[model samples]
Structures are given as C-alpha cells and as structure tokens.
Target: MPEFNAPLRDMRFVLHQVFQGPALWARLPALAGTVDADTADAILEEAAKITGQLLAPLNRSGDEQGVTFAAGEVRTPDGFKQAWQTFREGGWVGLAGNPEHGGMGMPKMLAVQFEEMLYAANCSFSLYSALSAGCCLAIDAHASEALKAIYLPQLYSGQWGGTMCLTEPHAGTDLGIIRSKAEPYADGSYRVSGTKIFITGGEQDLTENIIHLVLAKLPDAPAGPKGISLFLVPKYLVNADGSLGERNAASCGSLEHKMGIKASATCVMNFDGATGYLVGEPNKGLAAMFTMMNYERLSIGIQGIGCAEASYQNAARYARDRLQSRAPTGAQAREKPADPIIVHPDVRRMLLTMRALTEGGRAFATYVGLQLDTAKYAEDPDERDAAQRLVALLTPVAKAFFTDTGLESCVLGQQVFGGHGYIREWGQEQLVRDVRIAQIYEGTNGIQALDLLGRKVVADGGQSLKLFAAQIRSFCASEPPYADAVLHALGQLESLSQWLGERASSDANAIGAASVEYLQLFGYVAYAYMWSRMAAVAKAQRKQEPDFHDAKLGTAAFYFERLLPRILSLEASIRAGSSSLFQLSAEQF
Candidate 1:
C-alpha cells in the first residue's frame, strides 16, 4: 500500500517565506496575538503527525471496508469512530472556526495546510470534518444570533456533523428550479420537505447529530433563484436548554454506491416536514448558501492538491526503487543489472511535471488563502476590497485549474508505476478514482469556468481581471527571474479578456463557447505568476537552504519552459469562438 507523508518543509516554505503569512496575521487586528510563527509551525507539525499516523494507515482499509448502511443508519469503517474521538478532542474540526464559539480561531492560511494534509492522508475522513467547518462558517456569517448560539458551538466542537443539501432528484446545476419547499409556521420555524441526493456526511456514525443546511423556497417568495431560502435542519431536534429532543422528520433514505471515496456516506436524504429554522433572510437562501458553497469550492479544490501530492509521493518512491532499464547515455548504477527508472528521460519528464504542478499549486493555494484572510481580517477598507476582488477572480480558477491539472498529475504518477499502477494493491488507481470527483462536484469545472469568464471577468467589463493583472505587473516591476515570461502571459490573458468582452456584445453564445478554454489560459498565467514569486524568494534565500531552494528554482524553471507555453494552444482555441461549436445541430449527430 502507498504511504503519505506531509510535505512539511515545503509547506513551511510557502507559508513563511513566499507568502509571509505570520507578518500578515500580525497586521490584522482580528488575527494579531492569536497565532504567531512558532504557534503555526507547531500546529502544522501536530497536524502532520495526526494525519500521517492515524489517518494514512486507515486510507486503504477504509476503502476496502467502506461504509455500511442498514435500517436507515450508516456506520463508518473500523477505527474511524475512535479516530474521530481523538481528532475531536484535539479540536481539529474547528481549526479555522470563530473563537467566540469554542473554536481555536486559526487563520485560513494555516488551516489550508492542515486541510491539504487531512485530504492527502484520507479523502473520505476529511469530508466529515470539512463539511462541519463549512457549516460553522455559513452559520456564523449569516445565521441569527440565537441560531449561532445554538448551532455553532456544537458543530465546531464536532459533537454534531454538518452537510449542505442542494442537489435534488431533478435539479443538479439548475438550482433555480429546485422542488424543495419551506413552509412558515406560527412559532417562527418552518416545515421543510424535500429529497436531497449526494449529501456527504448526511448520515454518519462519527457525530451525535447531523446538522443539515438545506435550500428550499418559501411560499411568498419570488421566482427562480431569488425565491430560494436557507434552512437549518438537524437529524434530531434540539430543545431550548441545549439537550437532544425527539427525532426530527429527517432520515437517510439510502446510500449511493460510488466509484471512489466509498467510505464517505453519499446519502439520499428525505425531509418530510422536518422542523427547521430559517438561517439569514427569507428568499435569500442562495446568497446565504454561497457562503458555504464558496468555502466548499476552495476546500474541494484542495482535495485535488492533496490527492496529487499523495500520488506523486508514491510514484517518486517507486521510480527510485523499481529498476527498469539502463540510462541511454550510460550505466549510472553499474552495481545493479539495470538503472532505476528515475534515470530514464521519459520518467524524469513525468516526475518533473508532477512536481512542478503540485508545488506550483501549493504556492497558489496558499496565495488564495492569504487573499481570503486579508478579505476577512484586514483593517483597511481598500486593502480588504482589493483582496475580495482577487478572491472572486481566483476562486473559480483555483477550483477548475487545480482539479483539471490534479487529475493529469495523478495520471502521470500512475503512468510512472507501469503495470503495478493498474493494480488495486498499489493504491495508485484509488487516488485516481478519488481525485476525479473534484473536477465534477462543488459546481462542475465547466460551471466554474463560466463563472470565471462570464460573471467575474466579462460581467465586470474586465475590471476584476485588470485589477489582478496590475498586481502581477507590480511584482514583475521588480524584474524577478521569469518576470518577462509571467508578464507576457498576463498580456495574453488581458487581450483575450478584451476579445471575449467584444465578442459578447455581438454573439450571445460566445462566452459559454470559450469559457473553459479561457479559464485554462487564466489558470496557466496565474500559476506563472505564482512561480515567478517563488523563484524570486528561492533565489534570495538559496544559500540558507541550498537543496530545498535549489529544487524550487529548478521546478520554477521547468514550469516556465515546459508548462507555461500550453497557454498558446488555449489562446488559439479561445479565438476560434462559438461558430465552430454551434456548426453542428442536434440532428446532425
């Protein structure tokens, strides 16, 4: 079986040297004095231990055993319950939750590292905690004070798990036409009725109760998405005194047999007039739910990074140990009958691609986390607004690009293993199966691309894109290594954005036709920017940590030379426009 060890050194490098997370935290009034460099490092160390020791061992076994569902109750695999108890006691579920509600109050910058570790160790195990953390965020952000007082503490404490119920039987991406209904009652509560599918942690044995944040429409609400509202529905009703009351009308109808992450209970949840309270304003559920959805979008994106990291580790180890053939130039290892596969040029290409994409993605994720932290905690209004715009521009790119390349990286890792990669025992196949879902879920990558191109960029007249470009230009002004390459890529992105904006005026279908490719082009440019920043830091600090910084510089060079040029093909495809795509009619096939 493959093993996972958190890349603690690289993680620290990104957090401290590249992003300067501790310095930013000290400047934010809400985060200052909460956590410093030493404390954050200790937290990362402890997280690595828990994930590597407790969760990594269970990954394969959990997949083999999976989850058992009987009589409407779901039980997790062996050792999961015990592990959950230990994890809860450690207060890991609420690592980035609000401190006023019994959470540890860590910044997203530090929390993202822990999240990557959690998913890398075990994707299924991570979902239970991730959902709860996202739930706590939504409730704290939009829920009433009474609701927050009642729900936030338990959810953050891990005594109760959480889930977001959005996809219905008929509605997948078109949430505006959802059939779920919320009827207002006289006692200031509502009766929720709906059947939600693909609900993760909707029913699990790890927690005492499951808190579901369901989306439904009120009777007097407007049409389409504006009619939607958010509700807090728990499996078991809670009394005013904070004790568990009678069981609510919510129940798990069944579990879905999935391709991967089988240990997670993908539930078919049925709500039959379940007692639920309104969270935030009525007829504003989609907005309220976006609080959780955006968080989950980024969280799911990290899921991709985690899987890729684990796959790369196994493949790299295999390359070093598994001898295949002699090097073409000469025999590097004369003692052995054949040289290790790492000596092969093709194998080196695959490994370097994996390393470059994974490492570049790590830097990018930390950068996004910094933007998130700045948006929430920064004292200056202008600074916060700028960070918010960047977050809006980058979140979709993070989700789509990370997973899109994440799958590619995993496939490359598997290819390095040759025949053994196809076997189940090697664990490479499982990583491939598990990471594939990140591209589909939390709003499919296609939808994410459309949001990035149509809503974030073109809808704002390319202002958001320009704002982000200016940031990159400011960095390039310092003339760092690969600065010209990064600037050139940024220029391509700007020209493409203007082209799409002009096309949108004349052609209605132009945005959708070019969205996916546009997002890809945008992602490559953003990663190039990330690589440039890291290269600058690595050059300045190479003497301090020669081996680590040298590897970083090498990977950055590989990214610039070999990977960044893919944007050219993407640019050409985007310029082709919607004419080719619409040429074929429905009957032509």
Candidate 2:
C-alpha cells in the first residue's frame, strides 16, 4: 500500500484559519470552555498518530484477506480487532456524543477532521466506528432516557458497536416497500421479523455487542413512508440489571462479497421475531431514520474526500520520486538520467488538480461541519433554525459533489502513476475501488442530486436555496480580494437555480434530467467560493506563514483557472433541458 500520511497542516488551516472554528466554538454555549484551539490541536495530533501508524499498516493486509464468516458469525481480518480496541480505548467512538452519557461532546468541526483521517488511513476500519457514531447520534436524539442509560454508555465506551438496517433484498432505495414487520408485545417490547441486506458491520467480532437500528412497519400503520417505524434490536438481550442475557433471535445469514472496502463486513441479517424497542413515536420511523441517514451521508462524503487525500499523498510522492523526463526549459535534477515526473507540465496539472480539489474539499466539508455545530449548539433559536435550513439544503450537494470530485481526483492520481497505478501493489487501484462505493451507497449520487434539485430545492419553492444564496451574497459583501470572482460565481449559481426552478415547474422531468448537471454546477461554484475564502485568508496570513500561504494562493489560482471552468460545461448541460434525455425509446436498442 502507498504510505498513508494525514494532511494535518491542511486540516489545521481549514479548521483554524479558513473557518476560525475555535472562534465559533467560543460562542456556542455547549462547546464554550470545553474546547479551544490548543485542545483541539492536541486531539487531532493524537488522531493523526493512531491513523497513520496503527490502522494504515493493516489496510492492504485486510483487503488481501477479507472478512470470514461461518456458523452464523463473522470474523474480521488480522489486526482489526486490536486496532479497533486501540481506537475505542482512545475515546474516539464518542467524540461527538453527549458528555452526560459518557461521551466527549466534541464539536462536529473537530470530529469531521478526525473522521477524514480515519477514512484516509483505512476506510474499512473507519466504517465500524462511523456507523457507531451515527447510531449514537440518533439514539441520543430520540431514544428514551432509560434506553440511553442502558445503551449510550456501552456504545460510547466501545463495549458495543452499531449498524443501521434499511436495505432489504427487494427494496434498496424505496424504504416504503420494506416488508420488515414489528409486532407489539404485552411487555412493552416488539417482535421484529424480517431480513436486511448490505448491512455494514452487521456482524463483526470487533465489539462484544452489536446494536441494529432497524426500520419496520406496524400492523395498523398507514401506507408509504409514513408507515415506517424505527427499532433498537440488540444482538444480545440486555438483562434488567444491565447485564448480558440470552442471545436475541437476530443472526447474520451471510456476508456480502463486494467490489471494494472488502475488509468491512457487509452482512445479510435475519431477524426471526427478534426483540426490539421503539425509539421514537409510532409511524415516525422514516423521520428518525433520517437522523442517522443524514449523518452517514456526510460521513460517506468524507469517505470520498479521505480517499482523494490518500490518493494525492501517494501520487505526489510518486511524482517526486519517479524519474521520467526533464522540464521543458531545463533539467531540475541535472545529475540524474532524467528529471522527476513532477517536472512534466501534464503531470503537474494532474497533481495540481488533485491538490486543488482535495484542499478545497477539506474547506468545504469543514464549512458544512460548522453549520451543523451552529444548528446543534448555537444559543439563539433563530440562529439555530437558519443554520438547520442551510444544513438541509447543502447536505445532498456536499454528499454528491464531494464523492464525484473525489472519484475524479482519484482517477487523476492514478493517471500520475501510469502503468504502476494499474497494479495492486502500488495501492492507487485500491483507492479507486474503495472510493467507488461512496458514489453508489447512501442513496446513490443520482438519488442525492434529485433530493437536492427536486425535493430540497423545488419542493420547498426554492426557499432553502434562497437561504444559501443569501449566505454567499453576505460573504461576497465582505469585499475581499477575490470578491468579484466569488460574486460572479454566486450570480451564476443563483441564476441557474432560478432557471432550473422555473423550468421544472413547467416540465415535470426537467428537474430529474437537469439534476446531476445542476449538482455539478453547484459543486464547482461551492468549491470556487471556498477557494475564494481560503485565498483571502492566505493573502492576509502571507506575511506570517509565507510558504504555507503562498502554496494556498497558488492552489487557489489553479482552482480558479483550471477547475472552476468545469462549471461552464455543467451550466450548458443544465440549460440543455430534459428534451435530449427522454428522446431515446426504451426498445431502441
């Protein structure tokens, strides 16, 4: 595997310099006094150590020997169990969880960086903890206090792991079609009977207990998504005194053989009348499940970013070491038979594209994290509400755009390696394979685009989009050096949003046809906005941190000159409308 190194300097720049996360934390009552720049830096530094040293070494080895399953149980690859223990003992699982429930209560702003490191180091191992974090979020938000008292501590402490059970054999995207049934029991628990597939970490040996947050339907429930209900089905039943009891009826039927992230166990779960406890109000499961889904979407987006970062690290290192050709003008390394590949203009372009996207993405993801923190921790109600609205509007964009660009960046990274990239030993191929799932899972990029364009943007009468536009306008109003460029891109995005909104109203298929392109356009514009912000900060800090700020400005220039031009093509496609998409008949072939 390519040597994995966490980009701590860039991560710090995004958090403390571009976003001023510590400043934001100082104001939020929930984070005030608990978190500071020094504290956050120390934590991230330790995370970098663990990810780069412990987890990364096992990445290629784990992939070579995927999970093994037999006799209704699954075992992870060698060293995963110990690495997971190290991860748990470090108090990472509950980093963003409630402190009152044995959690660290870290802000999302910091948690996101830690997440990126985990993914970049080893995505397969990261999923186990990632799902656990999402499960903790949903349970903390909606689960009963008694339930919290019993499960929260165990989950956060890593005595148990978590998984979300939604997809079944017959239904993947359509949760309403699920056949999982939950029958009421006189003892206040329900009997859950159904099977779920593609369940990550559904059955693993890393933790002693596994908690599955399942979606099911009640006997007298309404039709469609409204009929769904969320349940907490444990692997081992918890006794009245919080001790382990007999095993539950739930068991792993089989493990999924997948294209990538092979080290992570994707199980086929069968619940034969398993005991379950309802988390929220009856018939409100869809809404509750979303709490976890949204969290996973963002994390999966980070998964893409993580892979891109890893790819860039390996590619950049290879470019500097591989001797290929001399520079156009002169030989940088005259003593050598040929100059390093980095001397070639085309390779430099590829490397710059990878750097520009990865850095811009880090800033963009941190911005979203800040919005989440504002929504969850801000003191004022109106501020929280506004932040929540922005989070809702941008979640799909972040999820889809990051993954799309991440995949693009990975391909470019592979290109830098040429023939070496095609082989398994170089590790670039694994990145391409691993990151591909990010685009497919979590409701797929196409589904995310539709959610952004049709549901989030169009269904709300463009209200959420307007909120976002207003934010970009406010930022541009600050009058930075690149304010004009930021303003122009924002203007283009706003105009396109209006154009798409009006066109969709007249043509029902307009949104669906234009969604993917619109999302790419929005993503490019969003990255441009982030680049502008970073450039402004870099320009101001140039005197203090000359090299770092100069590099930031150079990357910002590359993004503006080379990458931002992508929006032009995307805009044209969006305006091309739905006519071409539906022209082909189903039986034409």
Candidate 3:
C-alpha cells in the first residue's frame, strides 16, 4: 500500500510566505481577533492528523468494499460511520460555518487548505461534509431566519448530512427542462415531488439525517429556467422542539456503481410529496441553487488538487525506493541490483511535471480562496464588489483548470510507477479513477468553459476580464523575474478575449468552439502568474530557507520551461475560430 503524508510544509509555504496569509488575516477585521498565523498553522496541522490518520486508513478499504444500497437505505463501507462521527466531533464539518450556528466561521483562505487535505485523504468521504457545508452556506445566505435557526445548527453539527439535488434522469446540465414540482400547503410548507439522480451523500448511514436542497417548479410558475425555485427537503421531519419526527417521503431508489469514489453513496433520490420549506423566493430556484453550486464547484476543484497531491506523494516515494536498470551515468545504489528509478532523466521529467503542476495548482487555488474571503468579508463595498466579480470569473477556471491539470498530473504520476501504477495495490490507478469525476461533475469542464467565456467574460462586456487583466498587469509591472513571460502570456489571453468578444456578436457558435481552449489558456496564464509570484517570494527568502526556497524556484523554473509553453498551442487553437467546428454537419460523422 502507498503511504499518505500531508504536504504540510508546502502548504505552509503557500499560505504564510507566498500569500502572506497571516498578514492578510490580521488586516481583515472579521478574522483579526479570532485567527492568526499560529492558529492557522495549528488548524492545518490538526487537520492533517485527522485526514492522514483517521481518513487515509479507510480509503482503500472503503473503495474495495464500496457502499451497499438495499430497500431504500444505503450502507456505507465499514469505519465510514465511525470515521464520520470522529470527524464531526472534531468540529470539522462546521470549520467554516457561521459561529451563531455552532460553527467556527473561519476564513475561506484557511478553510480551503483543510478542504484540500480532506480531499487528499478521502475524496469520497470529503463529499459528505463538503456537500453539507455548501448546503449550510446556501441556507445561511438565502433561507429565512426560521429556516436558518431550525436547520443550520443541526447541519453544521453533522448530526445530519446535506446534499444538493438538482440533476434528474432527463435533465443534467439543462436545469430548465427539470420536471420536479412543488405544491404549497397551509402550514407554510410545500409538498415536493421529484426524482433527483446523481445525489452524492443523498442517503447514508453515516449521519442520523440527510438534508437535501432541491430545485423544483411551483404551480403556475413562469416557463423555462426562471420558473424554478429552491426547497429544503429533509429525510426526517423536524418537530417543533427540534426532535426527529416521522420519516419524510424522500427515499433512495439506488446507489450508482461508479468507476471511482465507490464508497460515496451517489444515490437516486425519490421525493414523493416530501415536505419542503421555501429557501428563497418563488420561481427563482436556479439562483438559489447557484449559491450552493458555486461553492461545490470550488470545492470540487480542490478535490482535483488533493488527488494530484496524493498521486505525487506516492509516485515520488516510489521513484526513490523502486529499483530499476542502471542509470545512464552509473548505478547510484551499487549494493542493490540497480539504481533507484529517480536517477533516470525521463523519470525525473515526469516527476517534475507532476510537482510543477501540483504545486502551481495549489498556489492558484489559494489565490482563488483569498478572493472568496475578500468577497465575503471585505469592509469596503467597492473592494467586495471587485472581489465578487473576480470570484465569479475565476470560480469556473478553478473548477475546470485545476481538475484538468490534476488529471494530467495523476497520469504522469502513474507513468513514473511503470506497471505498478496500473496495478490496484499501488493506489496510483485509484487516484486516476477518483480524480476523473471532478472534471465531469460540478458542471463539466465544457460547461465551465462556457460559463467562464460566455457568461462571466463576454456577457459582462469583458469588464471582469479587464479587472483581472489589470491585476495581472500590475503584478507584471512589479518586475518579478519571469514578469516578461507572464506578461506575454497574459497578452495572448487578453487579445483572444478581445477577438472572441468581437466575433461572438456575429457568430453564436464562436463561444462554444473556443471556450475549452480559452479556459485552458487562461488557466495556464493564471498558473504562470502564480509561479512567478512564488518564485519572487522564494528568491526573497533564499538565504534563510535555502533548501525550501531553492526547491520553489526550481519548480517554478520547470513550470515556465515545460508547462507554460502549452499557452502557445492553446492560443493557436483559440484563434482558429468556430467555422471548422460547424463545418462538419451532424450527419457527416
């Protein structure tokens, strides 16, 4: 079995050094009194312990055993229930929740790293808490005081898990076509009826109850997407005094047999006139769901980073220990039959590729996390507005690019392990299988590209993109060592955005054809900026922390040299326009 060690050192480097997390926390009034560098480090260290010790042990076994669904109740693999209890008791489920609702209310910048650790330890298990946390966010943001008071505390306490029920048998990405209906009653509740498929943690033995944030249409509602509304449907109805009442009408029809994260119960939820309370306004369910979906999108993006970290750790260790044919120079381990595989240049290239991408991705995720924090907590309205726009623009990128690079890194990690990587015991194959879902779900990467380009970028008249470009230009002007290369890449992305904006006005298919490549190009440039920032920080700290700083600089160099060059190809593809994509008619294939 491969060993799992949390990358606490690199995490600290990104948080405290690269991002100057502690100083930023001190500056934010919301976090100044309650959090600091020490507290942040302590939180991360404890999280590492919980994830590495409590969660990691269950991963392989859980995957092997999977979850069992029978007679509408789902049974998670052994140790999952116990582990979940331990996890909740540690206050992890409420780590970033509202303090008034039995939560710690930590900053997102801090909370996200813990999330990364959770995903690294067990993506399947992470979904249970992640979905719950997202549900809490939506409730806190849009639900009435009565609803928040009744549900938030219990959900945060982890006695009840949560799920977002949006997709159905016929409607996956297109929420406009969903047929679920809600009928209001005299007691200020609605009877919700729908069959929501692909509901993660929809029905589980881990928590006493499961809360579902469902989307459906009210009677006489408007047509299409605007006709939808959001509802809170629970597995067991809550009594007046907060006690559990009779079972609700919701039931799990079945659990999905998936390629990965098998231990997570992805259920087909059937809500037959289930009691549901209105979350926000009527006929505006999609907006309410966006609150949760956006949160899940970022969380899912971190899932990619976490899985890549695991793959890299195992592969790095394997390369160091696995004996292979003698190196081109000579055998470094003469006592053994051959030197360790790390001696080979090709193997080194693969490992460095993994390291560079994983590390760069980590920094980029952190940057986005900070934006989330600023958007929520900044005192100045203008500052908050800018942060919010940036968040809206980049959330899709974080979700898509991180997962895309994550899968690529995992493949490279498996390459380093040779045949053992393909085998089950090594766990590298599992990483590949598990990380694959992040790309498809939380909105497919294609959908994410459309959102980023069509909605966030073009729809706003490129205002958000311009705001983002200004920040990049400001950073580049500050004269980091790789500033020129970073600026060049940014120019490429900016020009493409301008060109697409002009072309899209006339051609509807333009956004669709160029979205994926545009998103990838944007992702590469973002990572490059992150690398430049990291290298600058490392260069400044080289004397005091020689080894650590040198490694940072080296990895940044590798990224710029090998990975950042992909921007050129992406730019070429983006400039090719949408004509070629449309030229081949549906029947031509």
Best prediction by lDDT: 1
lDDT of 2 by residue, 1-589 (tens): 5878889898899999889999999988889978999999999999999999999999999999999999999999999999989989999999999999999999998998999999899999999999999999899989999999999999999889999999999999999999999999999999999999999999999999999999999999999899999999999999989999999999999998988999999999999999999999999998998999999999999998999999999999999999987889899999999999998999999999989988988898999999999999998999999999989988998899889989998999999999999999989899999999999988899999999988888788889878887877788888865678777877888888888888876899999898998888888888888998999899988999899999999999999888888888988888888898778899985
Q: How much RMSD separates candidate 2 from the native structure?
A: 1.0
Local distance difference test, per candidate?
0.94, 0.92, 0.92
Q: Can you tell me which runs of candidate 1 are displaced by over 4 Å?
A: none
How well is each residue in 487-545 modelled by candidate 3, as lDDT tens digits? 99888888899999999999999999999999999999999999999999899889998
Residue 355, candidate 3: C-alpha displacement in angstroms: 0.9
As a whole number from 0 to 100, the lDDT of residue 430 in candidate 3 is 89
lDDT of 1: 0.94
Q: What's the residue-level lDDT of 216 in candidate 2?
A: 97
Off by over 4 Å in 2: none
Clash number for each model:
0, 0, 2
- Candidate 3 lands at a TM-score of 0.99
Once model 1 is optimally superposed onto the true structure by TM-score, how far is the C-alpha of residue 514 displaced, in angstroms? 0.8
Q: Weakest 10 consecutive residues, lDDT, candidate 3?
A: 576-585
